[model samples]
Target chain A: MSTLRRNPLRALGGARQTPGFGDAGRVVPASGITSLLTGITSAVMAFLAVFALALSLSSGQLAQRWSATLSQSATLRISAPPSEIGAQTAAVLEILRTTPGITSTRVLDQDEQRALLEPWFGPDLPIESLALPRLIEIIESAGGFDAVGLRLRLASEAPGAVLDDHTRWRRPLVQAAASLRALAWFSVALIGVMMAAMITLAAGFSLAANAPVIRVLRLVGARDAFIARAFTRRFAIRALIGAALGTGLGMLAFAILPVAGESGFLTGLGFHGAGWLTPLAIPVLAALIAWAATRTAAMRVLRRES
Target chain B: MIRLANVAHDYGGRALLTGIDLHIAPGAFHFLTGPSGAGKSTLLKLCYGELRPVQGEIELFGQSLRGMSRDALADMRRRIGVIHQDCQFLDHLTLAENVALPFVATGRPVPQTDLRELLAWVGLAGQAESLPPTLSGGERQRAALARAVIMSPEVVLADEPTGNVDAEMSQRLLSLLVELNRMGTAVMIATHDLALIRNAKAQVSARVLRIQDRTLQSAGADL
Candidate 1:
């Protein structure tokens, strides 16, 4: 009973028989050493798969966020002499207010201007001393204002006013994020392939080592499916156990990574809310790979023996 | 039932068995005696569907062996039990488990009470929990016999079953075979032991056939 509890499939009802009458032998011997090694390999591969899944999903989210934030806004830079700077700024504001899809507009205050320059220059640098261009922050409505139309209007109204819609930088940033997301997904797929290959190799090794066992089984009238099931079930269960452990460890690692609080690449590399469910698929996938690998190897060996 | 009509089998380049016409009927007990390397074991293998004849038709349970699929052969094996001289056994399994192997192979659960009775009948009730590697040659032979008849097969084919056991143990094993025969199971035994065949002829009406010069013939008035 205790043995069955530890491995429910070990002394299954199918193998048990009326005592002393028929041979109720275990069709295949328990391959502890090979199973352990395969399990460990599955675990490591699953861990990597989990990380790849997280990275791809998070990067995808990052791409969407960047596209949304950048797509909804534009900026107007007025580079006129001090005398005309005030007049050009007023003209640009009046034109933006009249333009369609311009939800809201605001002129940068002295403090806002200084904060924008703080990254490049010292915080204490006098903002009024240099003849910096006056900047206007524009927020677009859900029906975003047209960049080309706005630029044409500004060209005629205020020659010094330059409309910068940020598409030049936004497109590349979003593309890079999307590419990273795709690369992560590709990595996950590659990991799955490698896991299958490793499992197939391990299963082949096990079959070769148990040649005598197979011979005995065939002599006793055991079929190929029966022998294959013994191996496939053992390997599949091992892969499932190992992958579960690996995924847990992987999730733990992701949890401990430095959070990208405001906006950064690594910040988007972690699972959020229901996204945590994604890594759970890793164990199931590993088990399936193990089943396929072991079954193929067992059947091939049986065929060649026949 | 198994039948071979003008069957001939050959190795890569040499003819092993030729011009063989044989039929094994239900509840029939047959003993195939031949010298070493005279196709006695090969003939036994052919009877069990383990080997195909190179030259004629072989039928098992009314189906031709040439046209049977692998699955069909497996199902056919369920009805025919075979024992080898070397007594192949999964060493990792207990003696009881080894006996119940045929049931496992057929995807059926071994009935524990019946299995216990079978082990006791083979005089190995106490050795049920022992491993195969620990068993003596005689014990292994008895265990193999127990396994062979576990499925209650229609026919049992044994090759040199008593080759490795002592004279006393051989007689005990022969008694078990004779008992199976009385219960309506067809039995075929291929052996080189003339003394054992003489002993068996006294207990059961067994027809003794011998193979020599690549031909099968009845050993008239031998027993």
Candidate 2:
């Protein structure tokens, strides 16, 4: 007992130890390689986590852009006999000039009108070829004029004129974009939950596979902490690897996105300045998730063993 | 070094050992002999804190076993070396890694030269890199002895260390235990082989104890 007291670490390094593998002078530690893999997994998971975060951030941006840009624009158009167009245009300008909080109004020049119609009616066409409707752009102050009230008055005062607040046109577009952004965020949340579940399962299976090894370690007096360290380190590395690969591929795909607003469907979908740095955070977040998962699994298993 | 008084153990409502009393003095070499299922192994388990006695007192190094925290028990275990009948090993690991497991568990590193010498002493110098599954029964027993002594523990408790080995291998393993005894380490061997026990008596005085009807007695003692 006195001798054992002097060498109180016997159980941890006691006999009934392994007798095969490595050289006499340099025996390798069993968990060394496994732990390295865990570290790799941690890095990969962190990489993927950045992308998850990116999706969430972009979703919020999309929602805000929809609400902000869609809330404030209106257009007015006048269709009349060729002789009465000037009269209608003058009457519209006079009405706009007297309205409350009417900031500024511009009558699109013939060139601007031609450019607007250029898509369907080819360039260089004679201006008098068809009964062209006169288009006017309006700007309003912070507390702008009431759109509904103005349209009602316009309908009565100028039968050949119509006021469009652009609300109906922009509503569906913004709603669709907002919904798409929400879906992206939902996908990101699902990925995170999946990553956690996958990592947990992987760690648990690995621990089960190494049951014999764990038993021997315990017989030799290993503590729960020591055993947990090996597995936690190992699983974390695995997650890191998977996440990094996923995040890398995600970035590559994002890079090919058409310029924002270049097309209606793809408009503002890509990241803005400094947003590139946003995705870079995925790997770190992935690593954190891996760390949490492996640590949880390892501790759970070790606690039961001890 | 260890004491068990009126110790009783039960498994699944069946009694394995009942009313057993034994005391092992410090720095003593002793042998426990009994038939299979007579609880020799169970007694060792009780002594090592693996299984608690249902009724009785167990004291290790003069401390009561009851109410001892796991950490405290683990601390106590660190001082004693125990050898199992099967000589369990982490098969995936090499011999050296296996031997160094205790060091690894305790969060310490063994010196390379000392490890080499120990392996050489166990006659497994060439098999250090081999896996546990590839080792012969005798070699594994010797390796176990080496690991037990690695920490230079004061007490060594072995359960049927020679059960799987041939006569020749048994002598070699016994010799290692005797040597450890000569070095002032308390040794306890649980075996029913009288020939081996008689042989062990040749060089040094050893007290023999026996278990009968779940009770320990010193009738066959030969010093």
Candidate 3:
């Protein structure tokens, strides 16, 4: 190809016309360098966006886990005299065994009782010194154990049994987690909207400041789209670079976090499996914001000036 | 070539230019002169398609100015070089780069030798690397001329190119325009300097168009 054919400017123009873009990659008006700072801001925004996404996902997972684990299992407690305690426990187990969704029932040994009390009282305390009720550990099948009917049957056979299904606590826990997920998603959306607005404002200021350049370029026969492309491309690249840096830093921060044994939310707010690629999306988010901001500003400026 | 028929301009309903008829054939050197606020610059802007006429007709190379597209007007601008009284330049660029801005904006590849030659011709060869803000008024005017004519346009419109320069510097700038006219480019200089006009008349047969009362007409035969 001829030397003229090899020019970068023409090659920049060969693609879709970017509004107000001067040359494909031609940095005109020297203000194009501002993108470096703006790009960093965009990257930071993307990093935060990633955190927002993680919060939403983790909250949802927490809701799902709470709903699955606590909704099924229920415990039956029988209090009776020393002579009647074993018989009441046996009757409660018999009722549970015939129940459709009850998977298994087991009576706790004295060692387990001592273990449960170890946190509040000293472990060396004599087990025989206190009166203990018979405690049964009930396991429910997949859907959930029937609490209402089982409680009625246990009441008829054993007068002192109390059925605890965990409905009151489980409902509130799952609701709290679901609400948290919604809030996290709302936060991510708000950040995206703010990023769009910031980019627009920045791009608008850029176009406004470069008024003379635009006039000069226009007078020299450049289309409005040509002038806009320079800005759009610059900001997009800046946002992408900024987003990449931010995402990397965010991930690094996440990596050093205390694992499952340490922090609750912090440990959960990280990319997992294919989620690792989630940070890579930071650059693309920045690019999208830059594109939107630059496009709006470029078109408005071009329309008004042209 | 250009033609204007009863061209009147109004800004917010106040007459800035009224009922003006003027013509300049190809290669003609014309001077537009009037007192401050008499609309000399406004006339020049109208002539060059910067400001559209409010109540008259303008034709450039035989195309109606009223119906022209923005792109079409821009293309016409490339053929006409305009130097404003406040010659704006990208302050960050060196003088050489400023002078070559027209070619760059137009996507015309400017040869390095040609740029150097043009700067040298304007006596700015030594200051080529200096920014516009650092250059003196005289240097800026010269640089502006170099920029305006970088593409070798068919017509040149200068709005007080020598307004801020000394007499000697003014003469030097006038000589550059004269040289360009001699090379077949029509030059219209908007200035209040009769001495410069007379000095230019001695070298080239020139016509004076005086703008007054929003109208343009030839000066009295004596002056």
Candidate 4:
């Protein structure tokens, strides 16, 4: 029992790579039709699991990016006739500089304004002749300015100026990103459960097929642990191999994805940095599931049938 | 080495054996003979730790069967070898591997020379690498006997070890059992063949016990 608990693979006659006297562990073949089915199933599930993990990690990164970029800044848009636009923009900039916690402010240059509108309007449009709103970008310190007091001062000084703090849009974007991360994790959990169920069925089939061998071992005074070890070790190794194949293929699939541009959600849809190590755990997790499933099946059958 | 007191065994409310008292000492030799459906196999099962007695206590090597854990019973069973009437063998294994199954079950390093010698003694040295399904009935019996004695068990219980062999092969197997008995290994053989019993009596000092009408009795005079 101590030996079994300490080194399960050794106890199963797998300690040595060669077969000899008392090497009955190979009596149950590690590769067979049932094992093939189990391997294919594990590979498919692990492939899905890798994608789910990548998606979850990517969504988490997306949330962090959105929170960092949107939380500390406010935009001031001044919509006035062509005559008063420059005056309104100058007044808003002055008010922003006087406000506490307003560290820096910048009014957009003609080219920067044109670049921002290039996505919506054609680049050939003449920015000098258009009656466009003058936009002021405001950057806040750790302590942001009081929005209500600043808005009152801006209303009195420049009635056409409107302050947009970006909170209304930030709230929904952060919520959507957080929800996507949760959904991705849920997908990963579902894949694990499905894989466990499939592997359990495979383990049960192997146990049933090896009933005669188990009987002979028992007749010769082999303990239940000895019989169970033979089965669990075989299945565990099979699952590990299958999961490794799946994880490798999945990672290769991720590598070929189209590069993410700066415009949309695809920019944060895959693994990065330390997140690459996350999928490696799939194979080990598969092996653990196989071990637990095979052990339970072997013990139950031996108790009921033997 | 094994004792059963007032042992009663039943199957689904049907009593097959009752009031059975047996004691197997070291180097003792006994033969059990009974009619068909007379519970000969059941009694043999009880002698080892395969089947627990229903009503009475069985002590194997000084430990009560009721008190021993399943693993502990398996430990005791390693010390007591068994040969079934069917001569069950793992068909996937070689004949040599089948003969060394006891050592395998006990997780011991099987000595190649000892395994070779035992197979040669059983007349199966030439067929060591042959699969079990390809062996003859007598060869299977010899292989099972070799496997049983490989552990040098204190007691051996055989359920019609010669059931599938010819008379000549039966005699040869009986001689092997007598030789084991001479080496201080207690043995009990359950068979309905009276001629084999007579042949065994001529070679060794043996006792014959018979089960009749659900009771165990000495059939020494009948033998």
* Candidate 2 lDDT by residue in tens digits, A1-306: 332343354445554333322332222134555545554544444445555555556656766676566555567899999999899889888888888867888888888888888898799778767788998988877677888777777777776888876778767866776676677667666666776776787678777878876666666666666666676555555555656676776677678755665444345454567887776656556666767886788778866663
Ranked by TM-score from best down, the candidates are 1, 4, 2, 3
Candidate 4: tens digits of C-alpha lDDT, residues B15-70: 99999999999999999989989999999998887888889999899889887876
- Model 1 lDDT tens row, A1-306: 333443354455534423433333346677778888998999999999988899899889988999889978888899999999988888888999899998999999999999999999989988889899998999999889888888888899899998888888889989998999999999999999998899999899889988988877777777888888878888899999999999999999988878768767766778999999889999999999899989999999988875
The stretch of ten residues in a row with the least summed lDDT in candidate 3 chain A is A15-24
What shift in Å separates residue A201 of candidate 2 from its native position after superposition?
2.6
* Candidate 2 chain A worst ten-residue window by lDDT: A19-28
Q: Tell me the spans in candidate 3 whose CA falls farther than 4 Å from its real position.
A: A1-40, A57-186, A212-222, A261-268
Highest lDDT: give the candidate number: 1
Q: Candidate 4 clashing pairs?
A: none
Off by over 4 Å in 4: A1-21, A29-31, A74-168, A260-262
DockQ of 2: 0.21
Q: Considering chain A alone, what is the TM-score of candidate 1?
A: 0.71
Ordered by lDDT, highest first, the candidates read 1, 4, 3, 2
Write one digit per residue (lDDT tens) for candidate 4, span A88-180.
888888888889999999888889999999998889979988888888888998778799999999999999999999888988999999999
* Candidate 2 CAPRI classification by DockQ: incorrect
Better by DockQ, candidate 3 or 1: 1
For model 1, what is the alpha-carbon lDDT of residue B63? Answer: 95
Q: Write the per-residue lDDT of candidate 3 for residues A181-241, one digit (tens) a residue.
A: 9998898878878888888888888888888877766654566666778788878877877
What TM-score does candidate 1 reach? 0.82
- Candidate 1 residue lDDT tens string, B123-198: 9987776678889999999999999888889999999999998899989999999999999999999988888898
Q: How much DockQ does model 1 earn? A: 0.32
Candidate 2 segments exceeding 4 Å error: A1-54, A70-186, A257-265, B62-69
Query: How close to the true structure is residue B199 of candidate 1, measured as C-alpha lDDT?
Result: 91
